[model samples]
Target: MDAKVRNNTAHSRYELTVDDATAVAVYEIRDGAIAFTHTEVPRSLSGQGVGSALARGALDDARAAGKKVVPLCSFIAAYIERHPEYKDLT
Candidate 1:
């Protein structure tokens, strides 16, 4: 959990760096909505919770910014669905 997920607005994504690999959750902001597009984790880092961590961080960022989230990415939709506290974010 020490890994910090940071928002890279220049690339319109949230990223987390592990030992050697990077996990990214892509997003697009337009017309006041933040649309989560995709999430990717290096195969070598699979099953280590990197993706979940990345998702959580991205959602948290959106919440803090008081922005509406459009979970276009299934992973993000599922994450919010499973986490009821975040359901109101959509």
Candidate 2:
């Protein structure tokens, strides 16, 4: 599986593409903070780590840009819990 992640800023989402499936982690950027709003991983793409890829990519982007993270989405918050390096962003 050739999966890749991209930040589509115009759409406010970090998209993870695997084969024909695409998962998205939607977010909002405001006042130097990025609030992760939602995560959508299709059933066809479930259990393939697409959601984790999206979460990692989005959080990495936030860190690279020096932006704070408000993980409104439970998935992202949980991801942060698993990856403590990103905790300070919250």
Best by TM-score: 1
Candidate 1 least-lDDT 10 residues: 25-34
Please state the error at residue 4 of candidate 2 in Å: 2.2
Q: TM-score for candidate 1, please give it.
A: 0.96
Poorly placed runs, candidate 2 (over 4 Å): none
Local distance difference test scores for all models: 0.92, 0.89
Q: After superposition, how far is residue 19 of candidate 2 from its true place, in Å?
A: 1.1
Regions of candidate 1 where Cα sits further than 4 Å from its true position:
none
Per-residue accuracy of model 1 over 1-90 as CA lDDT, tens digit each: 799999999999999999989999999987797899998999989999998999999989999999999999999999999889898888
Give the local distance difference test score of model 2.
0.89
What is the Å distance of residue 44 in model 1 from its true position? 1.1
> With candidate 2 superimposed using the best TM-score fit, by how many Å does residue 21's alpha carbon deviate from the native?
1.2
* Clash statistics: count for each candidate: 0, 0
For candidate 1, the per-residue lDDT at 76 reads 91
What's the lDDT of the predicted structure labeled candidate 1?
A: 0.92
Where does the lowest 10-residue lDDT sum fall in candidate 2?
Answer: 1-10
In model 2, which residue pairs have backbone atoms overlapping below 3 Å?
none
Q: How many backbone clashes does candidate 1 have?
A: 0
